[model samples]
Target chain A: MSRLIRGNAVSADDWTELDDATAVPSTAKVIVSLARWRAERETLAAATAIGVRVDNSADIQTLWPELRDLPLVALEFPKSGDGRAFSQARLLREHCGYQGEIRAIGDVQRDHLQAMQRCGFDAFVPRDDQDLDDCLRALHEFDLAYQRAARDDLPLVWRLRRQA
Target chain B: MYRYDEYDQKLVDERVAQFRDQTRRFLAGQLGEDEFRALRLRNGLYIQRFAPMLRIAIPYGLLSAAQMRMLAHIARKYDKGYGHFTTRQNIQFNWPKLPEVPDLLADLATVQMHAIQTSGNCIRNITADHLAGVANDELVDPRPYCELTRQWSSFHPEFNWLPRKFKFAFSASLNDRAATRVHDIGVHLVKNDAGELGYTIYVGGGLGRMPMLGHKIREFLPEVDLFSYLEAILRIYNLQGRRDNIHRARIKVLVKALGPEKFIELVEAEWAQIKDSYLKLLPQDIERMKGRFDVPAYVDETAADDGSYTAKLAADSKFAAWAKRNLRAHVRPGYAAVFVSLKANGVAPGDVTDAQMDALADLAEQYSFSELRATHDQNLVLADVARKDMYALWQRLSELGLATPNIGLLTDLICCPGLDFCSLANAGSIGVAQDIFDRFEDFDYQHDIGEIKLKMSGCMNGCGHHTVGHIGILGVDKSGEEWYQVTLGGSAENDAALGDRTGPSFSRADIAPAIEKIIQVYLEQRDGAEESFLHTYRRVGMGPFKARLYAKVSAETEVAA
Candidate 1:
């Protein structure tokens, strides 16, 4: 519910291709989270990963672990400030170690890429008209960080000492 | 005073230059207002009701005289004369221009100080018992640990972007003067059975709209595991904390919802993954920091110093009274802790003028072993002053009106800088605070009145820590007019509890009389001065105080009572 952002098309309630894994594919085939979020998301994740998209709330306890091995995981960012997806992306890469394509779908702006990248999302799936140049700049912006991020193992302090 | 080392100097210098660049970009219109908003706040600049207010962190409220001179220089050159000392032991200049912040920060950098993490949702300045190294009752000086935490938390990467601002306090003694119960993370440093220092960690406590005391998350967490454990807690909160709604973002609500046991499991699990890593406290690093805070040189002397102090007392009763109130044991012979009160009558609490700050710095340099502290009560504490130098110190401090000698009395109030500066405030806190202070100026009466805490906040934000004061006054605005609300029997000691408000609020003029009535009732019915007001008030019920506060209104409502 937090990802509900208002713009051209995406809403929080509407899941991308691989965001949620659905049991009843016949009923909700319209939505699918890219890279298939079914594998990386564990059932302990408080939310479920249904068929291809749109998981049931009650099934999150069971389905999250069931979808831990999905080859491709697509995390959704329905809103700018909605940080639930940050947790989702992190759980996929760090805990679940889902190494395939982790596309940042929906409301993935240039500014938010830093946190998203730090949290472990590899590839960004921006809007068609969005500038790729700006996105690339954000990826290369700050070369060092102080905390242990899902993406980088070396915190800034260690890096500082290494240089010394 | 702890001098800045190479690392500290480099960090501050780089930070100022970075801010200077950021400020230039913003003025050049490269960064939009919203983008620049967060950036400016990270540099401790905020757009307030009047002008841009800059909050500078007085880390644990410890600063050398020369550093204070630099602060005074900043106030004179950049700000509008004075600075407000916050309840959290930090100071804020109300009228600094946004454009001038870079230069101001540069000025501070020259003195080895910068306002980094003073504002924003980052680790705030660490605070401890004001009488840290010198308080007679202290187990071990908490300043080294405070310094350690200060260094670790400053610009810490992973925890910087927390859901909300985190406040951490350390207390090394049995008496909880640091208000550990009400901090995000409270560390109680204690010696274990094996003669090793360990900590009892309290998490989730904060004072805001949802005021809740922190729960003990970790008991006997060894000193070595401190930083790693803290990092684990931050990571858990950062990853799992609800960032959707800011109101529910503080770790308090998260800990409340998750339950402390599960939260513990989560943190321990996280810590296990990161323990023994680089974040672990190295013995040498701690030793280096501790060495800097070595005990100041002490000269041996006895209580009966040449019969000179007693002679002064015989000559001057005022000096005797002042000595009795302001002087406390310094854990060293021939030295005493001098309490320089900022709570002068009719003045804003904790606020000192640029001139006064320079004078205090000069005095500290000359007499107080070059060290001063900002007490939680918003007063100044000279941690080490010679016992033989009392008269001279008093004379100099009295000249600048700094030696009020009302350390814990009526004039030593904790008040918020309400509607005058803060737009979030509902009523004027300064006026009521002034009224309370000016009304209780008689030294004998105040001393006889006994140790009482008068805390006032403009609203329930609890900036003045009204919840812990014995006589808590909260400001409420009713139909464009300010009314003062009263609460009794609150404390911030080991036996800490929130004060309870009486039935209704009072008009500004009636507040002093209501308090007077309550005190009169206590005086008439209480045992003696040895029994503190809070102790006596709690021993009895709020019934008496409540009854007196509402006596007139209750009389009008009832035909006969």
Candidate 2:
């Protein structure tokens, strides 16, 4: 029952996140844990508009080939200081070329929103009690970036040289 | 020095604004302390023992005269009228107010300086040989590569919060003045047999509680694949480095745990996938970065033995002594690099007063092409002083109390700001250094003893590089008292090796006398005065020094009993 910042604006979250042991409802927008997705792969593959949640501990490379066509992939940050999910989000976008929707869930705060977005997290379910407006404002904090990420096609070095 | 472009300027400015907002949020109690601690540390703000210490990065230790003047002004206006230059080539104000750090950062950004990544669990400042562009034996100037790495590592999204703090050092000369062997990643820029530029990459070297020399991973990684290789290594470390224990989280431990062979395999596996990415540096990109570091103009004159210079040397023996010690051979024939000793008697090793800083700024404008550098030994350098202007510069520097003729002598010790300033320090380092200096106060005795690196660290963090000193002193806490453990034969040069610990630890009062006794052994049993303390220690093993130190300690204990 919370709003998510999806692709630069607040959006109504229609998806229902099901625990690993929960039963998947037919024709409902549902997100399941990586374990549940793997355990019920053939059954969940036939469902409509389904997503999978990958924990920071799980390797995103293992979910490839079968989970490539999912409409949504939510990466979890178990702790604010643990940045393993930032790499996972980049691997999903740049490595796997999954272009549907990448959401950042668990421990997401205003300080992490911009970097998370640059690494290809389009939807953010911020940590509870953080202001949504502040998280949105964090996106515009930096106008220039030095390295190339999933958001920028070319690095600032190349772009600056081209401009000159 | 690399000049910032419009993009670089804007990036720093925006970062300042971002941190300002973050500080506001933290003050408003919206952001928790744990979350704000990580952000503040990345920007080089530390809540220290007495007050907040703000470390401002001097990229590759290069600074313009204007920047030095600004630092002096900040020291005068913000905190006390002094600032401490660190071994990482950054200046730290130990008494800055917590709320005023953002404004101080804004002031630094005006001078094209920022403290970004100076601390925290990310890549720290990319240090180079202080004599980088001016060194006679340098293969290539390391500043360009350092700047490139700095930009790549700044605000890097994935590696921002690594398992522990990472450090990188670059050296291009035969002598490893940058201490490359003691860093997490040591890049030695070299030209291959084919006359093409490449790098010899070393990984897993670090100094702390566990000191291990870096293992050479790749002997010839091409210049173009530098960033890709670095990214590959960092990705491996980020994913695999230990996160359960903060003490064992540095990449060195991971490299040791997996062994260099397995670590290389993992990094190569990762590199095979991402080698073709946009992180690869193009020739034009290298050229563009190099263009920012244009060489300064030099006069075409040889360093002839002029009558005036000879007469000055003959007239003042002190000037001759200072010249023999403080001057280094510059790449330019007529010029010499001057090492301004910050380790004057009784003063803290790297602490400089505002007046001294302003005087150095003025001197840089007058003689050294308006440029200065902070050496890793916590000293300042005027890198382009002319041979003819040497005497005049020495006279002026003497007037400022900076003309100490102990550049590489026994008294030129690198001592950390220990318990006086650092909250993590277990004992006082500067007090011990002062004690050693008082014992060896005679210039003639110091010159006679010759070429001994006496480094002291207040704690096991080894910021003072005590592990690699020829005579290393580590401050330990024995219950509630400060005790020092001495080591022998460590070096940070091309033949880098960790020192072996001498017998048992000594009390703070007995530490200096124990060192004197060790030096006494070297003096008595050396081949000649030509043999340095290190060479002598190497030739005759540590047995003699250990025996002498312990004999004295036993006699003193027996007398007390």
Top candidate when judged by TM-score against the true structure: 2
Q: How much is B374 displaced in model 2, in angstroms?
A: 0.6
Q: What DockQ does each listed candidate score?
A: 0.14, 0.70
The window of 10 residues in a row where model 1 chain B has the poorest summed lDDT is B299-308
Q: For residues A1-164, write the lDDT of model 1, one tens digit per residue.
A: 22322222233443335224444233332234423434543432333333333211122223456455544445666644444566556555655666655556666665556667776766566654444565565554554454445667424643454444
lDDT per residue (tens digit) for residues A2-104 in model 2:
7889867877788888887777787778899877887888787666778989878666777777569889998998887788888888878888888888989
lDDT of each: 0.74, 0.89
Cα deviation of B142 in candidate 1 (Å)? 1.9
Estimated TM-score per prediction?
Answer: 0.86, 0.97
The local lDDT score (0 to 100) that residue B269 gets in candidate 2 is 84
lDDT of 1 by residue, B193-310 (tens): 8988888899988776677788999878888888889877877786677766878888898999999999999999878866777667767656777877746766667642445666
lDDT of 2 at B26: 93
lDDT of residue A154 for candidate 1:
29
Candidate 2: tens digits of C-alpha lDDT, residues B5-78: 88888889989998998899899998889999999999999999999999999988999988999999899989
- Model 1: CA > 4 A from native: A1-164, B302-310, B558-561
